[model samples]
Target: MPLTDTDRGAMLSVIGASSVDDLFVDVPEAARLSGPIAGLPNHASELAVERHMTALARKNTVAGEVPFFLGCGAYRHHVPASVDHMIQRGEFLTAYTPYQPEIAQGTLQMLFEFQTQVARLLGTDVANASMYDGSTACWEAIGMARRITKRGKAILSSGLHPHYVSVAKTMAKYTGDALATSAPTLTAETDIDALIAAIDGDTSCVVVQYPDILGRIADLTPLADACHANKALLIAVVTEPVALGAIRSPGEMDADIVVGEGQSLGVGLQFGGPYVGLFGCKDKYVRQMPGRLCGETVDADGKRGFVLTLSTREQHIRREKATSNICTNSGLCALAFSIHMTLLGEKGLRDLAGLNHALAVQAAERLAQVPGVSLVNDAFFNEFTVTLPVEARPVVRTLAERGVLAGVSLGRLYPGEDALANGLVIAATETTTAEDIETLATALQEVLA
Candidate 1:
């Protein structure tokens, strides 16, 4: 398949170019490479390339093979085989963006159902098809709130995931908005009073995480009320969507917007992504929501059908007027999420959430028994923070070497913060078992001792 000098010359002639160098005449001569790049290997056979890639992949420590407990955003959950099989159907797998309503009914209908399911789960009036992921969705929610309130300031709760806060800050810098963030507390509890006090007339939205990064669940109703009194919007973030099954939804808590990572539902960690984002909001703000919205309607024959009702991305409208510049939705991942949710009905979801909580409680009890360990939160879902006698990062590394993937170290996320040096965030999902918990407990104890 490699092109010969004759083939290259023929192609250049067809394109009316004397040489390949002519194609890049616009690029600065100094910027262009003088010759073939150094240190790169020459071409190899297919078998040799495959062997090299397989060897590299083998070096990774996959979550399924270890006593894994890693979770800040991505989580390890049991995805039903049916989800994969269903999404792989030739039609569903190959379907692109459903821009044509008449020809893309099947894709549109699936999206409609996905949106309905997300709306119900988040307790919002309407939900978009999907977003890039939870972090980007949160950033978009802030933009939507700014559009609604016509404000310039966004107040972020310290308990929100640090990664999410970083993303918002990055977006705000380019958009010429103001972001006021609080410092994380020692006890890992959200400083609700401070967040309320930070609100001012110029505040557009207050973002807080439910079962926050430390896994402490906050009652957002009071915060929502305070934001409303100040003419600011309350945006609730849920990193673990399964917690919605066992706790109050953001809508029930009067939050104006709810955004979250749906990876726990049907997606695997995949070492980080290819995850789905869930975005929903109050009925009145549906028009400002980003991404596509699928709606049900009657055709000329009086038969029911689905169509892309609201597409507020730049591709569908004027660039300045579009709600977001996101070009498309995560259709395949959304299909996987919808299928997994359908398999786990209300009762099944509740049972799964309960199981995750029970496992976490058991792990917490065991970890607390360690000589110098203390639980950080009294109220939490399936994950929580623990304070250790020494810095947590080294302890976690030691445990990993001992064949137990303990958990995330807070110091890694908020480096150079003295208060968080000894803090560790641990998660126990339904996939965690008695044996795995015991293994983690024993390994952690040994490392700390």
Candidate 2:
């Protein structure tokens, strides 16, 4: 696939570069590699390539292979065998975007079901088809709030995931929107009071995370009331959707828009991505919500049918008028989520959630008793933070080397921020075992010692 000399010369000429190296003029010379990667061949046999890749893969200490406890946004959940089998069926697997509703009845209907389930799960009036992921969906919610409130300032709760906050700040810089951000403290308390006080006439929305990034749960009703009083919207972000099974939904708390990552359901962690984003909001803000929306209606012969009711994106409409500019989404992942939700149903989901909470409580209680560790949440569902006497980053690495995935350290989330250096966020789901919790505790205790 290498470009011909003519191709390379012609491309370089068009870009006003004399050679390929000229294209990298902006890169720092010290950072540039002097030669190809060591031990990596420029070319290799097909079998050799596959063998090398397999070797690299085997070196990874996968989540399931270890006593896993890692969780900040992504989670490790069990996916039913039937969920994968069904999605792999040719009819569902090969299908692309459902542009033609006539031929895409199955896809449309699945999306309709997905939307319904998400709406109910988040306690919102309507939910979109899907989005890129939680962070992008969050930024979209902020944009929607701006449109509705006619304001450019957004107050971001310190408890919000740092990655989500980073995404909002990046997008806001280009859109001329102002984002109010602050680093989270390593404490049991949330920053709801500060967020409420930050709401003002210029504030478009207040984004608060449920059971937040630190896995601390707090009531958002007062913050919601404060936003409403200032004509601003309250956008609640949920990173752990499974917690909804045991706690009140943001929509019920009067949050205007609710968004979250749906990876905890059927979408088992696939290294990092592709994860589905869940977005939902009140009926009044349906028009302003981004991404796709599927609606149910009867076709010609009095038969129930589904259609793409709203596709407010640049590709589907005028770029300037479209509600969102998101080019694509995780359709397959969304399908997996829907299938898993269907299999679990409402009662099953609640039961599974209970098991998760039970295991988490056991794990949290056990982990807290370890010397040099202290639990940092007054309330939580499946995930919570625990502070260590020493910086958690080294402890996490030491535990990993000992065949245990302890947890996510605040040092990793907020680099160079010394205040949160000792904070560690841990999540325990149904997959966690009594032995696994014990393993993490013993390993962590030894590492600290």
lDDT of 2 by residue, 1-449 (tens): 68899999999999898999987889999989889999877989999989989999999998888898988989999998999998986556632568888888888888899999999999999999989899999999999998999899999999999999999989998888999999988788999988887888999999999989888889989999999999999999998888898899999999999999999988988887889999999999998999889899999999999998988889899999999988667989989999999999999889999999999999999988899899989588888998999999998898888999998999999999999999999999989999999999888888888
Worst 10 residues of 1 by lDDT: 89-98
> What lDDT would each prediction earn against the true structure?
0.89, 0.91
- Runs of candidate 2 exceeding 4 Å displacement: 1-40
Which structure among the candidates has the greatest TM-score?
Answer: 1
* Alpha-carbon deviation at 274 in model 2, angstroms: 0.4
The whole-model C-alpha lDDT of candidate 1 against the native structure comes to 0.89
lDDT of 1 by residue, 333-372 (tens): 8888988998998899999999999999999999999889
RMSD of each: 1.6, 3.4
TM-score list, all predictions: 0.96, 0.92
lDDT of 2: 0.91
